[model samples]
Target: MIDVAELRIGTSGWRYPPWRGDFYPRGLVQRRELEYLSSRMNSAEINGSFYSLQRPERYRAWVEQTPDDFVFAVKGGRFITHLKQLRDVETPLANFFASGVLALGRKLGPILWQLPPRLAFDAERVEAFFKLLPRTSHAAAELAKRHDDKLKAEPHTDPSPRRKLRHAVEVRHPSFAEPESLDLFRKHGIALVVADTAGKFPYIDEMTSEEFAYVRLHGDEELYVSGYSDKALEKWARKIKGWGRDTYVYFDNDVKVEAPKNAIALAELLA
Candidate 1:
């Protein structure tokens, strides 16, 4: 039998200066920002890891700062997605997993791999990358053992073997909107990210995974700037309610400090 789908709503990232005195209360220290955000939202997407590998200590500190039930969706490193372009990334993937990502433990959620706009859909290349992904924590740990000397000094190689992992791909190029791309993702149980980039990226709403659905709302009218209106939130609420699979919605419109407010607004509608 299928389990009841869960809805996790929050922002793409939490550390925003503009949020000070706006979404965040005045005098709230920068370090305590995550602690405050967790009090209201159930999940958040960690985008820093997308830029570079994060140490295990940082991931552990994040877990301690948040509530027990909080979950974090980590963005895969750009070194793997953008630089390598999903080619010959076995060791890069291992290094990423070893670089303390597993420290999040049970609070760890899906791994998001956002493809660059310049990278078009390549079926063979995409399939090969998917094959390299570890299906469970145990497999991830084993893969982590293969990390290069770069992470040998301080790596989080071991993790709980009980939990399974999920991955989702966010595509930008229009080439990914075809049926072939959707079928490829379905064959591998990878969620095709429904990215709302305000006409900046190709938006594909198809659910490729039976396990879950991932959505990123960058903005409604302007990419990373505009806030979602009540009307837009209502429309999204309806769409999410209709998705039978578990859903994760993260607001990425942080430029104008609208992400948190919009996330709360969308969560309220879903509630």
Candidate 2:
């Protein structure tokens, strides 16, 4: 298993609409936020490409700004997976992999393939898509439940197909939180992405699971409509203490002021 203790936690630190009011002056906000976050966590998941194409020079600038250990987990563009089937598309998966995006070298983390609710688990499609991926790059698949029975089954064990690839599975449905699901992840060496949502969701109980933890803190659900709260930060800090492995905690609720503060608080706890 990968050393989970080395994993850093933070939110999807990309400039978005909801944060425009608080994080005005996009360029400055991005630079400062990156600096602040780099001081605490070593990794972040980037969702910028989901909205637009990324410039290599801009990515190089980011690489130059952050520390050597800083890592970036990029979200695959919706055009390739969500909008168009893996079969035919304007932007091929091979092209995206070859793009300077993944060329960030060791600083590049896993490629997140967040599938839509409409994308059910089809063995054929899944097999074909996996074939197109680079063997060395890590991939995390977030599947929204459309087919229940197939989703419950274990990942196919065809060793002849790409063997060295690593995968993390994130399922929104409650059924995925079962012992079977956890066992499946352990058996297949798939990391479970623990999501903190508006309602009761099964986040991995740190005491029980030895697998790497991928946590997403979406601020306080009560204050989500307004923004994040300091109280919520304290609660998450306490919870993270129990995690034994490297944990990735991301703040999706508030990316502006709240994310920096919450990240500081969590880092203090981890320290």
Candidate maximizing TM-score: 1
Residues 1-271 of candidate 1 have per-residue lDDT tens digits of 1233677999998999999999999999999999999999999999999998888999999999999999999999999999999999999999999999898999999999999999998999999999999989989998998999776348887778469999999999999988898899999999999999999887788999999999999999999999999999999988887787799999999999999998988887777
Supply every candidate's count of residue pairs whose N, Cα or C atoms clash at under 3 angstroms. Answer: 0, 8
Candidate models: Cα lDDT each:
0.92, 0.55
Across 95-119, the per-residue lDDT of candidate 2 in tens digits comes to 3543345446567665666555455
Candidate 2 structure, TM-score to reference: 0.66
lDDT of 1: 0.92
| All candidates: CA RMSD (Å) | 1.8, 9.1
Q: Estimate each model's TM-score.
A: 0.97, 0.66
Number of clashes in model 1?
0
Best by lDDT: 1
Candidate 1 TM-score to native: 0.97
